[model samples]
Target: MSEHRPVETWLTDMDGVLVHEEQAIPGAADFVQALQASGKRFLVLTNNSIFTPRDLRARLLASGIDVPEDALWTSALATAQFLADQRGGGSAYVVGEAGLLTAMHDIGFVMTERDPDYVVLGETRTYSFESITRAIRLIEKGARFIATNPDPSGPSPFGTLPATGSVAALISTATGRQPYYVGKPNPLMMRSALNRLDAHSETTIMVGDRMDTDIISGLEAGLRTVLVLTGSTRREQVETFPYRPSRIVDSVADLIRFVDHGKPATH
Candidate 1:
């Protein structure tokens, strides 16, 4: 018998939910420590595919989050695992950086010569005409195309930059074929996460700062969702949206408080 009740596992977001640009959010570490004290499990989830688990773990450690790679899951890793499970050890034409390549390679996929089995795109600081053109050509040749994420833009200290959706649009224009998105707002990453963590959807709470991608994704996956308005999502913008989160907080700093006020459950 299974209890369709909430448990102590917290599948949290990284970039926006826990940190602001580079610094840790106020009381975020304390909250995590509190959760740890309760013998709960937590996994940091991020849509940004530019950093590997090791890379993000180190960065978070420097910022005082003290996370391990086993506790982290990125869109890049999920994208790789999704393909490897679906297509096995097929060669792929990559248009991302070292992190994206490394994740796929670690997951049993090989980057091969042009006209490879798939076209995998991710975040690259140096996305140029040549890079886009190469991806476009591969997609045109009937390569199975995929994007690590479909975010319209990237978050920066100042504002937005070219994200996966921007690059995907360029390829879509050229090839008339849509790249499969493996990040939030899609089931690919969430389903993969459930398998990797061996977590039941009923007890999982997808926590993030964005509503469209993170919240909707959790809802779509039949999991609970908590929205922290410490980043991209604003209160005013949320009222206009049709779907509302299960719970909302000012930041991860108040997650424990939110949990305290939550409806009781059994597991």
Candidate 2:
């Protein structure tokens, strides 16, 4: 490896980079442990807005990865922060789970369906037609639309399930109002996460398995990105995209040494 900048802060995707379907990927635990031991500022970023940081921390612990609650960043949090920054103490008509609701409440947002400032869409296992219908009606009445992520589907124990983007699309088709997605693939999410960590883009590295979301957002946010081939994206699939990652590794395990040594990995 040639001379390169050392990574002072790390941002990593949850599902594919560290774990897959509730199981920790090889070296994931070690990588996180190294980050903690080295006192590097890092956060686990997830597009899933279904679980709060506390809930996610427990889930990760069960899978042999011990991450602090504060070190986990989600689309739900980013959406809430964005809303608060845009218009402090605003209201929204929410269609999601505890995570989304809690984030909004933490930011002093009132959850309502009548004349809301925004119609918020997030990931949920059981997306009710009634709630979605209400959201559509609110949007028809001139409520702005905001969604957590643009992912159409998410993996589950059963199979692929409809996510926020899928529901947002239906609402958009019915109300002719497109949602402002606040999650991955949107650079705002990365900037929000960086702000949360008080970290600079130049000294940060983003690690994830997906090319479209993780790599692009990080690149646009001025952070070096790494694509790990252990989840949704494959090695061959990477070539299909015009953009490329700074480094390609088999898994998070492959980057453990680099992270521990505070050196950027070579392509």
Candidate 3:
């Protein structure tokens, strides 16, 4: 791998990169604190649109991480921002939870089912057949389709549960209209995050566990990327991808030294 420029900003994935199964990965807290102490602009990203930032921050705090609400970003927020930019103050027929709804509401979007301008889908533990049916009907009636992310399943103690992507596939099959996914692997989400931080791609580093989502999205958005083995993607799985991250490490624990020294170690 080629040497990367000095990283002036950081973007990291939440689930696998920082925490897993509701537990904070080792060194995750120190990494965050290092960023804070260095005064580097950073944001924690998540494809899950299930919780608002405040909710997520509280959850992180419980696990021994102290990320502020403002430092956390969700696909729900990106989806809401996309809608607000596309067509300000539009109405949507939403199928999701408080996080998605709150994001939409924060952006001044009206939630409705009667002739809405869009049929928005998000992650939810309990997916109502009635609500999905309504979304399909709305899409069939020419409402634009939007989804928060394209994750097929999410982890839980019970088992892997179907997520936004699975449901979006169902809706697509019914309406023959694919939703515009507004989360990871979509460069739009990364750009939106960078915009929020007022950071430039050249000086930013995206740390993530998944090659398909985090690394690819960062690469497409012109940011250097790091693949951490602490999350969803493993070391062996990374070589199977067409491209490579700028660096790969055992975990976030391995990167603290680089952060402290002021530049990633040359590969």
Candidate 4:
């Protein structure tokens, strides 16, 4: 028997739950609209740090999902929030795209290569060897290491490509320093989202596709978790994990009724 309170807020992963390969998954648009109509505080989250919320909004709009800009959260935004709270106005040597760069800039972080307070890593389609060498040297010079997310690889039309985690590993091998990741699988990300929404964990639900990152993080943060099959994890793979989600549904479509009723689904 579950002891959770009625859900008043929602935190859902963007890629697997709402979209797959830039296309809106079945019932994703309707799910977003339902949440909006219910007047519930919700956020669509992503671990991808390559694009800002505005950019992501445009992408989702093209796919027919209507999510407001402020309702969208990214690893880059979480990373910026983490940095701002930890050390205000700190400078960093960054290796990422506009999303990450803009977040740091918004927080008044000075971008530099010399004597930086941190070496910040994020996702980018074109990772330059030149920038990587600089990052390695900066870490060796005692700059703290930070990465937006620990995802080892990202999806590309051609195939899987190395992402922030893989690069962070390389930098660690070179400098003997591991980076502090500020995205999913880290309960700090969940706590940060909760703080952003002013939502309590007991009254909030986390909807995601991956068991390792999404389910685990939500469970650790004291939020009930739902695993949807519309993204990464296959149904048969659920039991392999040491921990389990509170519910396993086919997709966001199945969650619409619960949005209004706030009742636990029959498992």
Best by lDDT: 4
lDDT, candidate 3, 62-176, per-residue tens: 9999999999999999999999999999999999998999999999999998999999999999999999999999999999999999999999999999999999999999889
Instruction: Give one digit per residue, the lDDT tens place, for model 2 in 1-267.
Output: 235566789999999889989999989999899889889999999999999999999999999999999999999999999999999989999999999999999999998877999999999999999999999899988888999999999888889898888888898999888999999999999999999999999889999899999999999999989999898899999889999998898888888888766555555
Query: Of the pair 3 and 4, which is ahead by TM-score?
Result: 4
Q: After superposition, how far is residue 15 of candidate 4 from its true place, in Å?
A: 0.8
User: If scored against the real structure, what TM-score would every candidate get?
Assistant: 0.92, 0.97, 0.97, 0.98
For 1-267, candidate 1 gives per-residue lDDT tens digits of 034474656778887788878799987787667666766667788888888888888888888987768888889988888888888989898988877999988888878756689999998777889878888887778798899999888877777789888989989988999989999889667777887878888777778888888888888888888888888898788888899887787888777653433332221
Better of 1 and 3 by lDDT: 3
- Candidates' C-alpha lDDT: 0.80, 0.92, 0.92, 0.93
Question: What are the clashing pairs of model 1?
Answer: none
Native-to-model Cα distance after best TM-score fit, residue 90 in candidate 2, in Å: 0.6
Compared with the true structure, model 2 gives a TM-score of 0.97
For candidate 4, what is the TM-score?
Answer: 0.98
**Model 4 agreement with the true structure over 1-267: per-residue lDDT tens digits:** 246677899999999999999999999999999999999999998999999999999999999999999999899999999999989999999999999999999999999998999999999999999999999999988999999999999888999999999999999998899999999999889999999999999998999999999999999999989999999999999989999998989999998988976654755
Best-matching candidate per TM-score: 4
* Candidate 3 segments exceeding 4 Å error: 1-4
Model 4, residue 169: C-alpha shift (Å)? 0.8
**How far in Å is the alpha carbon of 111 misplaced in model 4?**
0.5
Candidate 4 lowest-lDDT run of ten: 258-267
- Give every collision pair in model 4: none
Q: Can you give the lDDT of residue 244 in candidate 4? A: 92
- The C-alpha stretches of model 4 lying farther than 4 A from their native spots are none
Q: Give Cα distance to truth, residue 139, candidate 3, Å.
A: 0.2
Distance from true location, Cα of 12 in model 1, Å? 1.0
Error of 1 at 72 (Å): 0.8
